[model samples]
Target: MACKERSKGDSRDGDDTWRNTSLAAAPASRELGKAWILKRLVHHAPAIFHSFDFPAFELGNAFEDINVQFTEHGYILVGRSQYEAAEGPAALAPTFAAFKDNLCSVLVVNGLEPVPHETVVESSKTATLHRMKTWRGEGVNLLCGAVMEPTRGILVAQQIADDDRWTYSATSTQRDRMLWFERVYLPCGRKCVARMLLVRRPTGVATSPCAPHWKPRRRGIAATPSSLHRNRLQRRGRDSREDGMLVRVRGKILLY
Candidate 1:
């Protein structure tokens, strides 16, 4: 009987060892994927900008709550908000909640770059293409929308533009939590005069960092560090094993 009990104990220890080993290996893979995503965003942003007419523009010195302009080329508008700079990731949840609340008629569009004129007028019209059709011919106005990924901490928005010809391309660099830099592009005869630049904040953290920030929250407020960390994992599409790892990490932190 004693021998059987010992055997059961050994089996339990072996299972625990395997489980722990698996959990330990997962974070490395997740980190690799995160790095890959950042690299891809960086790689693609320049190609999108190369097609812009005026690649650089001097940003106006005055910071306004909202700036709106109507021109023959298109419309231009930018909105700014102030936040307490020291909160880091803690600020993302509330900020993103506000962002999501404002997305009323917006649909998830593909790629954050200037849509080619031909592509916009394509015959077999994708949903985005179909939407483009409504903007074509005669006096078309600027199209406005928000691309949000609450899970990934990414929110790419266009408040106003000169015309419907321009689109935005984004890259995620993990420096700070909410830094952004934007450059205004003057119109170059309906060929998409895009305002392009690395969005920067006062503190220099470029945030809204990934596509997962758009995932709808699964109830409960994310106010604590554990909850924020959990929300991040959910954004990254964490599996049960990863979830367990987080719980263990939280437990360790609590014990310490």
Candidate 2:
């Protein structure tokens, strides 16, 4: 499922580097899902670049389902196992660091405004790429691929937004991916903070709204995740709570 997004002209060794490298995976939703996945992937680059050991955040079924496909051309990384096997553990930190540095440079210099989420969702195309400034004033590139299937969406993006800098790849399975959508993303609000608050629940906390043990009570009605989400919000009075701080960004009422 992995393929390279290469630029027009490059050396044979560069080509080999593309063959050797790959990226991460993403969520399938337009507004929250696409944005959430992109931010996570951007954060992940730095973590992979700095650490020799594979981080705990990169493990689990949720991450495993996401394959970070690059939009430009350069060397990203393949997978954890393939990377370690082919390049040895020592090559990881330095190689990933190089990729991160290069990508950051491009994003910082050539960035543009973020495309609206509604535009991305409404587009009838295979993919949509947006340009925007990061909070740090660095540039960010956002690419949301179309949801060809109802249950899944793919995203490919880079920070240093150039066509000649980084290579990307992807792989997928239909099974556990659905589990990720159900368990994690379904309970979230319009922004990423909802998931973070949900994750901070204490151990043995069964009442946490996103508790894995909780299930829908409506026996006869088949429910979509969104409906379940609305139910959770209404039932929990999540619309207004001490924990749900009001934030002003994008003219949206984000329940942080």
- Give the TM-scores of the predictions, in the order they appear: 0.21, 0.21
Q: Model 2, range 85-198, lDDT digits (tens) per residue? A: 223334434433342334323222222333222212122234344433333333334343322122212222422123122222112110000000111111222111100100
Q: Which stretches of candidate 1 lie over 4 Å from their true place?
A: 1-65, 68-70, 85-88, 105-154, 158-256
- lDDT of each model, Cα atoms only? 0.25, 0.25
Report the Cα RMSD per candidate: 25.7, 21.5
Give the residue spans of candidate 2 off by over 4 A. Answer: 1-124, 150-153, 163-256
Please give the TM-score that candidate 1 achieves against the real structure. 0.21
The digit string of per-residue lDDT tens for model 1 on 68-170 reads 2222222122223322123334444565444333322222121122333432221111011112211212111111112223222333322111212323211
> Among all windows of ten consecutive residues in candidate 2, which has the lowest summed lDDT?
173-182
Clashes of 1: 25
